[model samples]
Target chain A: MTDVQTQPAISTAQPEDFFQLLKPRVMSLVVFTAATGLVVAPGSINPLVAAIAVLCIAVGAGAAGALNMALEGETDALMRRTRGRPVAAGRVKKNDAMAFGVILSLFSVMLLGMNANWLAAGLLAMTIVYYAGFYTLLLKRRTPQNIVIGGAAGAFPPVIGWAAATGQAPWQAWLLFAIIFLWTPPHSWALALYSAGDYAKAGIPMMPVAKGAKSTRLQILLYTLVFVPVAIAPAFVGLGGLIYLVVSVAGGLGFLGLALRLYRSRAGDEPDKAEAVGREAALYDVRAQAKPARDLFAFSILYLMALFSALLVEALSGLGA
Target chain B: MRLTPEELRARKRRNVWIAAALVAFIVLVFGTTVLRLQQNQASERALLEAATGTTAQ
Candidate 1:
């Protein structure tokens, strides 16, 4: 038998490449959610403390993304969607990335503990571990429900921000958490439906790859249905107001309608046709599936941002009142 | 593509330095802020106590 090599050859690291591993887009979302949490809480946190808390959350988010890049680099290289990532592209070495992530993690946690409450800092630390260690390293490679369960990492920012302000987590903080938890599946599955081949090529068992397209679309619709009611629940809890209620209800209805349309469209038969003219009306069911899924993904982000922004406006107005 | 052992070690050294510098800067900024917050809290407490004492007298 020919000699079998188990390990692939590694490449050199670059200084600038380390920053690229941070997944800044994801970090920005985390920061925004965390800031909203801080602003909307009942009591006032010192401006300095609030600023520091947001900074800590952002750095912690970046650190987690960096560690994820390092651990998933090999798998990332195989997928077209992730092939251009810093670690995947060989611009950063795994060890260097790991070290960078660890250092940032430590600094962020320690600073948060000192500047804000230890409760908030501890939650931030746990969020990092949940994402980098539990989700990225373990859950991602093992199951189709990875994003569903792993979505907790993203959900924690608002809760952490609430804790940073109040020194304790409350039902309102958890309400925000539940919203993100429910939103993640449909949001991620929509993208997965469009990029199933990328996940399959990478040997990742995403929902679309493990199940059929019809099943994925059904799941997206089911989750969206479940998510809409929860999205509107904050109004009952007094965390939201008239503007939030109107925006969330309208946004939720739009989301459900789009998801329903996606479910009705069948793209499993002709993948190529789906990729090409999916946005246009077509006889082949592929276009029907692809377009609505893309629409849902784009709307989900806007939906969450708008809902939270409305809540922030209500909170600020309440403060003035 | 491959890198020589010397090149790898050099890269490693640079990364460590960069990480250390970032950590130091974050700590300094946050530590000063925490100190100021503590000072403000203490002064507020003192002022409240003085006001209560004056009212009682």
Candidate 2:
């Protein structure tokens, strides 16, 4: 008789499953922001090399995402928002995802170093380690301030892009970094306030789950107050121009209004709509009580995109040059 | 010693993808090397021109 225990398991994973492990949606945002930094930095690079730099940054971000999913598969299974992820859904094995992440990480960092400067490559490597090792393994389960700290991983791509272009990370690059770093708390907490149920189910210490929704709302308002001025600061500092000034001011006001509305509302005071209904909830299909939080969450993404797009336009047109 | 048809198909497709990814990586490396060489040569030429002009002065 054949010994079944000695045989290697056959994999049914398709390429789509592997792609899903990269978190394509998040990668798109990374690519956009990194591209903006490359375009706006005060230096010129060969177009092909610039494209390669952005590609490496995107792949590096994706690699970190793959590693995050591989490590958090079981935990992800318990959360509705993340349950459909490839590793969590069993479409991709955890070990396979881990290997994929490591391979991509190595290739991206090495290629980026050869194409750009080592400073950019080193930043990409640090971002991977920060997200996959420090944030995923250590901070996520231990603190309610997890996203606040872990958000640095998301904020590094622009700096890497700037360094790729100039081989130096000056205050201008860090100003861009600060905008994302501060924007993260409000954006994340707004989503967390609406999805507190899923976070609770997964035993994650999201602000809404750990500190209650009232505190979360207050903190979101406070953060919005701080984040907007910084978002507008780029204009005064000569890093941004008229178009950016308009976008940041208008979008920042709208963001503030939404935060205020969300703060005054009773959103997140109850379990999430999915929990209440005992079923999966569409990301945008929240209950009337939760709509304010949802509005802030949705608007936050639009506002950030507009702000970055304005900067990109100004730079490309030589208005900010 | 038997494998299901679905398993065989998936394995074949995966192998194809792996080959594609490897080819893409090789092309990227080769392109990057060529670009770097061109950049270095251009900068070296510029430096030589500057030195020759200074010597003439």
Candidate 3:
């Protein structure tokens, strides 16, 4: 067997090395969701405070990611997808990464409490724990349902942002939370479908690895089915306008179509076919994973940005009237 | 893949440095937030007092 073992070494750390620890990709999603919460809330938060809250959320997310990297450095080195990460590549020491993570975590929570509200700070703290402790340390290694459960960590930002604005979690905050929660499984499993072998090689039990590819595809379809209504639910609740309803429904249907295609492709059957599906799925995952979680991943970012942009527009229009 | 003693010691030292740096960074962030929060609270209080036209506690 090829040695999956990593050497212990601390090479000269590059600026990019530290940046990667923050998981910029994940930070973008967190920032957007948190900003959405601040924008769509009933009351106006000082722009300065809103900005601070967003920064804290971003920093807190980065800290959690750094800790995850520290904890999973060994496994990451074994996985093709994460082998190049600074910690996994032995460019950064695991302990250093952990220390950085812990310090940032404390700072983020304290700052959020002082600037925004204790409730926001508490939620941010829970998000760090959920991602770094519950998801990374435990769920990821333990089960195929990892992303499903771990997705909660990502979903909490909107709620935290809402609390920052309103100082309480409202049903509206939860509706936004629900949209992301349901979106997580399909969003991640698509990537997992492509990275199944990588995950399996690393001994990580992702859905495709534990269950068959067929089961993973089915779950993607199932979650996408539930995701559609949730995505558009804001319209009925008055959080969105007619424009939002139309866009959300159209986008939801488009997402469902993609999920359906993914299901029908049964593209996971042939190893050769896997690459084709991976390419197709990668198109979506890359875009969505970016900021919005929409052009498979790019469009995903746009999809969400547009959704919240609509809400902001509605708020502005209401104020004008 | 086992780490030699020297490598382990180096790792420990690096971790300590990183920890110190992170602590300093966090402290700066916290201080900035507290300052901002105090300013906001003061402004809000002033606004409320002006609107009421009284020395509201």
Candidate 4:
């Protein structure tokens, strides 16, 4: 609505452009968390069935990514960070990407139903719809809390994995879901704090764009505080082991420490790696200042990885499950 | 059909995605089929064992 959606086509479409539309990086995270859910479940699954389940999850995630890119083509064209995406860059046609998404979505869900259980297929189907329909089309452009509510879409992977393994999703699976759901706010807020202008320009109402940085930072701290306790709960509830307890508590504290640092370090003009160009609309030299936002953003990745890895290790060792 | 260079390029791109998707589909479906057959065979073996008062040695 801000401007005309269509832009002049630039380059011809290429194979790599189609591949890029899948957002493989995000797909890998989905695959990992979903696989962990399968592995850590109580009963053993046949390896072949397990592989099929994981692959279906990966395909479903990639399908959703394609659909997201197809919808966001216009805004993606406007943002410098997303300007080079397949549809936005004019490398692939919108119809082709959309067809690719719809086909993959159906294929993955059907395969999961055939290979795994109908429960898993249903969960995967809902996840695809939640992400591509509710989050991308409805929530993203409309509200600042879009990521907060939409975070459930990403959180569903572990639950789907659990369902695939046991044909049921109990409360423990939801605990894992809660960890990722809570982690999303701080993780995305860090990116949003650094890229506030990009969101503003794209007409997306992200938290940092609607609320000031100070408010967003404080909220990030609040979420981390809540996340750390919930993250440590699995061990106390007998779902995880000592290793998970240590990892969760340590990683949670590290995250909290970083959040506190970000709150206090209100220095002027630092070259954040996240901005790449500048901080707060001003492009400055490389030797500008320290950037806590970028630091927290990087550490959040490690935090989740460590938390999940601990549970996986303990489960594999027969100490957690 | 005769086509422009841009049209040909677009077609090629779409083909690549389709080919990749086909490969993935085959792999996933093949695995599922094999696993389902394996499970069926295992259950049949267990039923045979139960009927014969013997187990696989």
Better of 2 and 3 by TM-score: 2
Scored against the true structure, residue A116 in model 3 reaches a CA lDDT of 82
Q: Candidate 1 regions off by >4 Å? A: A1-16, A268-289, A319-321, B1-57
TM-score versus the correct structure, for each prediction: 0.84, 0.96, 0.80, 0.87
Name the 10 consecutive residues with the lowest summed lDDT in model 2 chain A.
Answer: A1-10
Candidate rank order under DockQ: 2, 4, 1, 3
How would you encode candidate 1's per-residue C-alpha lDDT over B1-57 as one tens digit per residue? 565675677568767867787787667675757676786888887888797875322
Show the colliding residue pairs in model 1. Answer: A278-A287
User: Which residue segments of model 4 deviate by more than 4 Å?
Assistant: A1-11, A267-290, B1-17, B44-57
lDDT of each: 0.83, 0.92, 0.79, 0.83
B24: Cα error in model 1, Å: 7.3
lDDT of 3 by residue, B1-57 (tens): 556677676566657776776786676576666767787799999999999998768
Tens digits of per-residue lDDT for model 3 on A248-315? Answer: 88888778777777776554443433333433233433322221222233345566667666666766
Please provide, for model 1 over A91-178, each residue's C-alpha lDDT reduced to its tens digit, 9 standing for 90 to 100.
7878878988998899889888877889999999999999999999889879999999999999999999999999999988999999
Per-residue error for A292 in candidate 2, Å, reads: 0.6
Please state the CAPRI-style docking class of candidate 3. Answer: incorrect
iRMSD (Å), candidate 4: 4.7
lDDT of 2 by residue, A1-321 (tens): 376754435888999899888999999989989999999999789999999999999999999999999999999999888898999988888999999999999999999999998999999999999999999999999999999999999999889999999999998999999999999999999999888988898999999999999999999999999999999999999989999999999999999999999999999998766777767788767878889998998999999899889999999999882
